[model samples]
Target: MRAITISEPGGPEALVWTEVPDPEPGPGEVIVEVRASGVNRADLLQRQGHYPPPPGAPAYPGLECSGVIRAIGPEVTGWQVGQEVCALLAGGGYAERVAVPAGQLLPVPAGVDLVEAAALPEVACTVWSNVVALGRLAKGETLLLHGGGSGIGTFAIQLGVALGATVVVTARAAKHDRLRELGAAHTIDYREQDFVEEVRRVTDGRGADLILDIVGAAYLPRNVAALATGGRLVVIGLQGGRKGELDLGALLAKRASVAATSLRSRPLAEKAEIVRGVREQVWPLVESGAIRPIVDRLVRMADAEDAHRLVETSDHLGKVLLVR
Candidate 1:
């Protein structure tokens, strides 16, 4: 087998594809022959040595993948060998083969291409868990999603609309039209517009009922300020720096709450539950065409460096995948 490895994390040039021992299934796990993998910002952080794989995970830099099952390990049932599936992985999606927990696997939804299915798991689970589960986003409310052109952002837009919530997003001007077509009711150019004002304005000064933010610190104050009374703010990524000042007075006055979550290092049981929720709730939306995989481009696995470069520049409208 061959996989991408980093000896000394530095840049996109650091991702080296080389021959390695093939993975074997562990208890309750399966070995997958990789078809394609989703490129995420976490992969970039891992390549730069800022993030490391969890214990017992492969030392590669992918968070999700679509592949066919080659073998199933002990204690796993219901899933059979040779099944086409996509998986939510903690690491190792950048390889020719990977060991995945059975609970993390999802069947390829009807009406989706196998390669494009690679884009579904992570974003689906993230949005379902944060927006639906934690934030409890209800119909007729507003959902303000940051990074409208991103994989997670694009998926959230469709899901929010499908659930009857109005969606607003922050992206560069170039992506606004496409995001709007994805069901975003309004788009704000985060670089040029004050998203706090835009979000408030679009919701008719009521503010967003739920805010899903990827930019952590830089937007914290504004996120709180833009929230409606009793609104919930979920921060799933720290693309902006890690440290920032918080306004307790504003948050208190609005009775808003903030939560920060990371999926990669969570316990297996928790991940399995999130995956289950996604399969039960979100998969139907996808299969019904209410939501679709948004693939910006597909680069070969051997050319992961190029994929990383594209993502680093924020040039993609959705997921950039690495295909076998």
Candidate 2:
């Protein structure tokens, strides 16, 4: 099997393509012949040594992949060799072969290409866990997503719409038109406008019912300001520095809740649970043509560095995939 490795983490140039031993399925796992892998911001963070794979996970970086099952390990059933599936990974998605827990495998949705399926798992799980499961987004509620041009943001917009929320997003002006066509009821250009004011004006001073934040500390105060009374603010990333002061008084006055979580460090059981929820609630949406993965570019596996560079530059409106 061929895999990309980082001998010393730094930049996209650090990714090295080399022949590696083929991975074999372990008990309750399946060996997948990967066709495509989605490059995530976390992969970039891992490439720079800011984030390491969780304990007992593969050292190589890849968070999600789409492929065919080549073999199943003991105790795994109900799936066959050659089944088209995509999986969420703790690591090792940048390889030709990856061993995934059977519980993590999701069948490629109808009308979706097998390779494009690679883009679904991570974004689906992230949106479902935060926007749907944890935030309890309800019909007629407002869901605000930061980084509206991102893979996760695109998914969040579509899923929030399909699930009956009035979706609002913050991105650059260049991306707002596309986001609007994708079902964003409101769009704010974070660089040119204050999102807090824009959101308040658009919502008639009521504020958004839920906010999915990826900017981390830099947006904390604004996020607090954008939330309606009793709203939920879920922080999923800290692209800005992690340290920030919070207005506990404001939170108490509004009876709001603030929470943060990352998918990678979660225990296997919890991750499996998220996967299951996405498979049940969200996968069917893809199958029914209500939603699908948004792929902006595909590069050869050997040129994963280029894909990483695209993601790092924030030039992608959707996922950048590496195909083997």
Candidate 3:
């Protein structure tokens, strides 16, 4: 099998495409013939040695992939060879083949191409786990999503809107129109406008019922300022610096809840639960076209380094896929 391996853990240039041993499925797992994989910020961090894979995880960087099941492990059931599946992996998704737990596999939705299904697992699970499961965004409420052009952001906006929430997003002006088209009731150009103010204005100063933030500490203050009474703020990434002062008084006054989490590094059973829930509640939405991944570009598998570079530059909107 061929994989994109980190040469020395530095920049994207360190990614080297080379042949490696084929992976065999372990008990309750499956070996997938990877067709495509999603490039995520976490992959870049791992490539640079800033982030390490969880215990017993593969040393490779990719966290999610779409492919066909080539072989199933002895303990696995309810699946077969050649099944078109996309799965959330602990690692090793940048390879021609990856072994994944059967519990983390999801079928390609009705209308999704196999390659596009590669973009679904990570973003869908992230959005569903945080916005839907933790933040508890409900119908008729106001939901604010940061990084509106990101893979998770695009899904969050669509899901938020489809669930009847008034979706609000912060992105560059160039991306604002697309955000609106995706069901954002309001779009604020974070570069030109104060997102806190725009959110407040659109929500009649009551703030938002739920806020999904990827900016980390830099947006912490504004996130608190933009929350409605008892609002929930879920942090999934730290694109900005990781440490900052918090307005304890403000949060106390609004009775807001601020929590941070990561989809990777979670226990397999927990992730499996999330996969099950998403398959039940959200897969139908994706299948019916009410929600779909927003793919900005697709690169060849050998150019995984370039995909990482594109994501690091933050110039592209939505998922950057590496197609096999």
Pairs clashing in candidate 1? none
CA lDDT of every candidate: 0.95, 0.92, 0.92
The positional error of residue 136 in candidate 2, measured at the CA in angstroms, is 0.4
Off by over 4 Å in 1: none
RMSD of each candidate relative to the true structure: 0.7, 0.8, 0.8
TM-score quality measure for candidate 1 = 0.99
Which whole-number lDDT from 0 to 100 does residue 269 have in model 3? 97
TM-score of each: 0.99, 0.99, 0.98
Q: Write model 1 residue lDDT over 46-127, tens digit each, in one string.
A: 9999999999999988999999999999999999989999999999999999999999999999999999999999999999
- Clashing residue pairs in all predictions, respectively, total 0, 0, 0
42 in model 2: Cα distance from truth in Å? 0.5
lDDT of 2 by residue, 220-265 (tens): 9889999999999999999987989899999998899999989988
lDDT by residue (tens digit), candidate 3, 1-324? 899989898998999999988898899999999999999989999998998999887788899999999999988998999899999988999999999999999999999999999999999999999988898889999999999999988999999988999999998888888888899999998988998899889988999999999999999999999999999988888988899789999999999999999988899999999999899989999988999989999999899888988998778988999998
Model 3 spans > 4 angstroms off:
none
Candidate 1 yields a Cα-based lDDT of: 0.95
Off by over 4 Å in 2: none
